[model samples]
Target: MTTTINANSHKSLIRNKVWSRLRAVALPDSRFHHDYSSFIADFEGSSAATDLLQSLPAYQNAHLIFIAPDNCLQELRYRSLTDGKKVIVTTYGIRRGFWILDPEQIHESQWQMASVLDGMENIGRHMTLADISELPTDIALMVTGTGAINLKGLRFGKGHGYFDLEWAMLYSIGKANQRTQTIAVVHECQVLDEELRGEVWDTGCDFVVTNDKVINVKDASKPSCGILWDKLEDGMLEDIEPLKELEAIKKRSRAG
Candidate 1:
């Protein structure tokens, strides 16, 4: 019998290893979420990771947060709402662009329901680039999940650039900036021992929280950039409505 490696790529191999580790755990019966096998999200100890994330001083202080729509982040979103923090989140794959989910608007009883993926669409108020630009508040934290990350603050996602684009659009509108704290939550198994090369728009995280502990990147080099309109390729403009809308907004701004 022969075993097959997924590919020659480093990130692919790391992702498969993490996936295998995640799958070995028997999911507790308490959490309600989509199957991890179906989506490139977290499993098993996601709640514990979220608990660690919520304990950080930055998380406690943040008034406005941007959370990725990963099942692993579902609990964090709920806690954010309960903590009275404003959550800026994109729908799955960012298909519907950005939305603002304010706890003040939602009844306290519904926070848990409203934080889930489907609930966010129903409860959150959709915002366009112009709408977001008009916001008086700036983002305090930008939290997400990734395929793999190393101590060098390098990160790789499941290949789609949704999280990168989310940051870019927000940065373009001045809703987010370099000073905003970024966090990547994952199971400990997902942490990489090898340093991955950084891209210009990588926007690596400042902190990596897992089920057991928090690892702060002491000398993280997070390079931030606004939307690279020229780099928009492979039908990205057509697929992501927010990017298309943002491109038009910037064009009109430049024209005026």
Candidate 2:
């Protein structure tokens, strides 16, 4: 109890510092521009990081990618479609499971609109883990935006663990694997110099791309053990429909 409390306190401090630093360079959603809003900030030229990522060999060769739905990642999601890559993204809050956006499915002019939260729903195909079991095993990238990250490659976001759970479900269902590279896109200010330890459920990234540079991480940790069932936040399994569905699917797979 004591350890958890201290950790939470520390995280609160870091969150405040990160938000302050980031707000200077990025625009928070208009609805959330207030003092306490925790929405990820979207910068005018944040797409520069997306361009940097695309120039990399891994991205160039990748036919599939998984991107988070955070506002900061909106541009990458759009470019992935325009580049003719199949994108896998969780719905906002991941409340609705995974969706796949194929450039072939939508008209070229709508690709940009299709990248946003509502546009994705209107244009992408909703899918379950079972539906994705047939995807090629060579998914090239799993990218997410973070509230704060350090040189140690440790990252956290909104205290929700949405991306962590999304990774766990994908891993458990065999849709994502160790070879699927992961990266974090953040403002340069969100990259901290101090090192921090990662929890067992903390899925760290291999690369940290910022507005200025892409830092290659030496030993970033990833969660291979899948969801820590016992450690999940209260009501996660109860409130999130897809998580419940995934739990059932994984249980039956083990039983069989």
What is the per-residue lDDT of model 2 for residues 1-256, given as tens digits with 9 covering 90 to 100?
7777777777778878888777778775866773424566776557888777877777778888889988889989988888999999988777788899989888899899889988988988998887888876556789999888888778867888888898888888777787778888888888888655567888888888887888888777878989888888898888776789878977898999
C-alpha lDDT values of all predictions: 0.78, 0.82
Best by lDDT: 2
RMSD of each: 4.7, 1.8
Q: Which stretches of candidate 2 lie over 4 Å from their true place?
A: 34-37, 251-256
Q: Write the per-residue lDDT of candidate 1 for residues 129-232, one digit (tens) a residue.
A: 78888988898899998766787666767766677888888887788887888899887777878755555767778999988889999766555577777766
Clashing pairs in 2: none
Pairs clashing within candidate 1? none
